[model samples]
Target: MLWLVPLFLLALRAVQAWSPTDSYAPGNVSCADDISLVREASGLSPNETAWLEKRDAYTKQALREFLDGATANFSNSSLVDSLWSADKIPRVAMAFSGGGYRAMLSGAGMISAFDNRTNGSTEHGLGGLLQGATYLAGLSGGNWLVGSLAWNNWTSVQHVIDTRGKDDELWDISNSIVNPGGINILSSASRWDQISDAVEAKQDAGFNTSLADVWGRALAYNFFPTLSKGGDGYTWSTLRDADVFKNGEMPFPISVADGRYPGTQIVDLNSTLFEFNPFEMGSWDPSLNAFTDVKYLGTNARNGTPVTKGQCVAGFDNTGFVIGTSSTLFNQFLLQLNTTSVSSFLKGIIGDFLKDLSEDYDDIAIYNPNPFRETEFVESNYTKGIVNSENLFLVDGGEDGENIPFVPLIQKERDVDVIFALDNSADTDEYWPAGLSLISTYERQFGAQGKDIAFPYVPDFDTFINEGLNQKPVFFGCDASNTTGLSYTPPLIVYMPNNRQSYNSNTSTFKMSYSSSQRMKMFQNGFEAVTRNNLTDDSSFRGCVACAVLRRKQESQNMTLPQECAKCFQDYCWNGKISNKTAKVSTIENYSGSISFITDSASADAASSTAAASSSGTSTSKKNAAASLPSSNSLKWYVAFASLLGMAIGLM
Candidate 1:
């Protein structure tokens, strides 16, 4: 019965909620509306700066309300008022990592934990912190989470969770993208027809089309099920007109991508990183050092203006297309063609397209009529090829090893004081993170790519595992004075890697489909991991989060850390310890592990005792592996199966 759901939905339809339209296709348009649409990437855009002015008041109040809940643990209760009254205020940011659906679902759970709007999130969790954040950045799969939330009128993650299991609801990943059919209950063939029509429209309009268009179209069906044509008519630039965004009720959302040339197989640290915000799309890297209007993305421009007088292009930057560009690395789906249930005719069409795509590069999002062609800027290794190119090639943001979207938040103009980096990367053989992404990002700061940016010192990946930094929340960039040879002070990084808590959440990134139970378990595990078992393991986690946010503001004012917060920093901050041993989780208890608040000791004891009893009676192969490493044959099978699937699908 469960297996039939996909086919049933594909064959039947109750509503014609959408129809094919050329709204997403590029078109020639007038450019005389505004002269200030494009500008140099010298600093924050006027629109963002003005929006921040309004958001500042919102964050101040949010921080106050959040800190008030934790006042019992604070030595200085009045500090919040003092900090808000001062000229400098604590600015916060949250960055979600890339790992396809794993990242999206895990990040969504963490978002729910951070949002005070979610019921019960404030009990023993770091709730209300999302409201205090100034910037939200995502790359690849991470983009899907933030983009979905931002575009859906800034909806709460709880709302999405509540809609699960219903037909054509958001986050109903019952069917894989390769066989996508939902919302309108069209057959897989029908869905492919719609996707083909959209991409063909872009191509027919005299613009380049790639697999990214198809990928984004598939993603749209899951993310925007209620919208017309599943959001085909929607554009990412339209977020600029949303009331929530214009009123500064939500944090600014940014999606990140990396630039690549045709036929380049490897993306290194020196690759230019570009960001797509509501106002514009561009890079802060010194090479191009410019930005242009995101609404008129297809317009051929030189020196920050359209090449043709009083003429430009519009509707080229579709919402799905923009999100897909950040995750073009997912084109590996072609490699798994035989594994999927896609129809033979559709397979042939995709196969033909992949043949042409592989000649250059399969993983790329094509942007014809380069907006920065011949733009006057400093000529460097990165700029010369970009300015001369007639087309722009963008790829996955994490293709360069920076899985986390930290580059945008660390900019000097943004003035972010702290960053909560949610890392769900599977860097180890067992699908656990080994802190390799952070190491890559740290190494990047010393290269030419780190022109105006500075990153805090980070140890090798070996130290990350040997010291258990990947298993819990660890603080980086704590001591500002220690960071030398940099143009600006880096934000304090609250690195929280996904780990086992109430549930083992080390699901493989390529595992696209999940049962409803698996989805809910992952969400629960994410909340437990972020709150560290609802502060049962360490009650000071909430206080520590507050302290991390207040670190830079206090240091700027030359204030000492609070008594409890000082102890928290000492336990959580890495103390320059290094080890040559191979990567492994540490067993050391950094803090006093105590469940002092006996809210329900009887139930807690019952849970542990029952779990142990169940484990002894059940086969080890089927039981949840609470420990880090895989010990059962079933898990090994999962690893092998996921590896094959990963090669076949290669999702973000």
Candidate 2:
């Protein structure tokens, strides 16, 4: 009888979470299930400021152990010790880029290198590095890494990996979203119906929903696979209460999305980069220099002020939705309903439902009533720039190709001293990053609005690979004083691009599916790339890391450069040389980044798949990442049909 749960759930609308927007918030008032905590404007909320105070205590302890030992070999043995004072100590930030699952697992392995908990992570490894940091940021696939850890109580990535099957297989890559791989008791039909209805509820609440809503729901099913019904009641803001996050036991998790003007084909570095932090969701960029409380995201606000005109809505920032919003490019999966395993009836419903939006089908997460409605960022007030008027259209972070996660790290206020950027973008013919992400940010910094924020000068793309800068670890902004393009000191960046040393972790950016073995191998490869295989391949990598970390303190104090650091800069830093000549563009041919330790045939299959696609093309060569969708209310039947069709999907 209990096994009949799936069929029973499909038969009814099902008593579920969330009131529809119509009933939740009708003509005159806002959502009835309004959360009391309305949207407010402020800098790092008192809550975050307070949490940082406590977390800094832990960070101070972590850095004392790490920096002192890592930098002991330098001429200034006491630099880490001497700069132990609160403000002077180097503030570090680790940023992960977007590249689907490759970015997530690879970032996981690299992050694992900084975790003492991972086996052999501490020996010659920067294990305590994560603990000493102030911020952790991710975009797209990287969001999965940061979001997973935060939602799971700030657990180690290794712990996340170890507890797969035993704990409902949270990161179990074995189960595709459409097919659960038998991890849960619910049938595929029940899962689809429930997610579809929840999305429909949002639509019913006077919001326009798209395939992205479905895409986000499907992603929620995978990232938060442990929930009773695929994380039904889980909200992103709920993370605020997690003891670890609230207490600041971990790095602040910041997930990013690119704000697309409705119907825009692509994004540039100047395109507003929006972030969803535990406390709020907004862009620090002046384009929309305001952020609302994360819990009150759906509350219709006018130009950064919450108007009593609209009611506040809660639980709209579902954890899955946030992560899904960051990676909305994955919505391409839903658009391919023709080939998807879903039934044709559901397919036609989705097709008909999306037909109007299909004309301008940009895979984006719509934040309704425009939080930044009248602001300069929302050019809706201007008739010329926008093809359609919509508030808060967010797409993949790398949609602009500024994939290094620098937007959140380089904040003048965050004052991060050095950023360890894990570059997992597929920017070259070989599918390995060739410093293009860095180049984009550098170019953006030249604009009138962005000029105040100084970025390290990087060589042209051809120079990035020609000089072997992309092949090995490189340092940018090494000399803070001598740099040309800045009003202030930008953080030194330790750029570690995905390479083929341990495993060619440069899987295709479009690739979503990966076998467990390939996934683990990618993680291992990332670990080795970060630690240089625990410093075996390049023992100097460790010493260079210590040098990069201490450079800021050395600069602030006007201390002379150490001989070791001098050598590091000469060998690893870009020397203002330009090479615009067309690059021969590097490629990894027939590369097998296979892990022999795992015997799963699934991994072997995935390895063959990865190698086959390695030479095809990179994300840079693809169509615009910010493709638009239609949300026009031209079809009245869509709302009615979707309301019923969504629930009736499983039966057909």
Candidate 3:
């Protein structure tokens, strides 16, 4: 009887006819009734119906903005304040070339002007004012228009060059934005001084200077100093401790095998610079004589090997070091060390000036002169960039004669709305957990703020238990479908607050009979379901299934919608699964594909015992490895994920 109530309400709406004026009447036709009918008609969940609605609203809003000529704007003062409040910080921008020079001047001038206008009470710098302007431009289309015009005018006058020359230096100059050598020499020098000073200061403060210290400081200082000091001090340790070793004596060199050269070069850890014995085969050989091999005297001499030494030859300007019988290792090590030190110094100086604008402005806003929070602005812009970058853009294949860059015309932001119609068939119960996990992980990584509601399938058993018995049921739909023979037919509908839905169907294609708004509601509902569902358990396959279904639906709809709609949908649904089997297989693969082993070890009692054992083992291992070299596992997993996702999406 409880299950039939929604069904009955839907039935009434389906049969009843109303005039245009009466269509808006809440009592006459409500989302509750509409969703109930959808559940009865399509066998999806009420949550899914709600998802579809929210999706539709977003799609519509996007279309409207596009059609009405509006631009998206983002702001947050908290993030900006936080960034500014940091003790050590990187420089945001480096003045390079004519355009960069002009921009810097403009930024500084604008800040000064703003300060004067505000009675010189603001603590913000020139970069902050520019950031504010950029933020405003991002929010308003008018600013973009003006900016474009200004850019064009500036480029026209400053970058004019003949395109016919084989050695067109103009292109070379223009490309200097991304090129290292083309940067302005004066600016580079200034940045280097700034970085060197900062590093020296840190060293004086007795901070734990390491490779990370150097790199992180470089990033914060946004400067690269010249390497006036000799030796190959470009190694991570040296760079990190650049401040510490400012006036310190160079360490003795050690002999390094040829095979380890690549690793040494990559991490700047060449033994030629900091090894204890430059000519010795290993780290140190105390028995080695400074001039010649000493006469045998004690047992320590017998055990100790002679340290290799180099002497001046007849025609050579300086004496060359020799290791064992070969001078090759000794000579090469010295050369590498000398080159690396100078190179790193130059790199540090240059890198500081070219710092990204966002980093600089983020720090500035942290001190509280803005209306919005700093974190909000950073998150919004970062997410927006991610979304924009993920969108599809067309390119010429080069094989064809057609060599034009023409993007697909997507629907305007205001015109089209998206609805996520999910398939919540019995098969979904197996793979929904993966989808849930993905949502949870993404939310944790990116910060959850604008996500829509999710629609899930509500079975008759839960409805009956909750409504008929007036008691909450532990198992919502455990008895509704027989797990042994799960079927794809008769999809259930659940309404969520947002317009998103997840559908699980056996067929490759399924009919969606809901209106545009209803479709969005379905997607939102599915999104919510996946978001709320616990993914710690192995059975959380529901989320993955929903994600796949929603992706497919979005893709299909993208084909018929405007370019922006397609782009947005494609970006969100990128790497989405097309089949239930694929979703299930992916989830299983993630768990190592051996369900039996995982399940056996994952049992409640077994898990507790195993956890205790692992903890004990870990403690012992940590103690033993405390003095040894660091392991690669310390790198964050999110960095790896971001890299992989970036590569995949970039290629796509």
Clashing residue pairs in all predictions, respectively, total: 1, 16, 147
Candidate RMSDs in Å, in order, are 13.4, 10.6, 31.1
Order of the predicted models by TM-score, top scorer first: 1, 2, 3
Candidate 3 shows a clash count of 147
At residue 651, candidate 1 shows an lDDT of 36
lDDT of 3 by residue, 510-542 (tens): 110222233233322332332222222212222
**Per-residue accuracy of model 2 over 1-652 as CA lDDT, tens digit each:** 3423432332122222222232222123254443333233335666667877877888888877776667667776655556664357778899898877778888889899988778777676778888888899998888988888777657687766676455455566654444443346456557666766777666666776655566677777667654555565566776666657767778888999887655444455556678888887876664445566776666665544456734665657777778888887533334333333456776775666554353465356777765555543344222212213345677778766677778778877777889998988776655787777776666555542253466766665666777777776788888876554356788999998777767778765545456677778888888888787778876666667878887887788876555877887887776656544556874232111111111112332332233223312221211222433465443334333433443332222
TM-score for each of the candidates: 0.83, 0.78, 0.18
lDDT of 3: 0.19
Q: Which candidate is the best by lDDT?
A: 1
For each candidate in the order shown, give its overall lDDT on alpha carbons: 0.71, 0.65, 0.19
Off by over 4 Å in 3: 1-67, 70-197, 220-440, 443-652
Q: 281, model 1: CA deviation in Å? A: 0.7
Answer with 1 or 3, whichever has the higher TM-score. 1
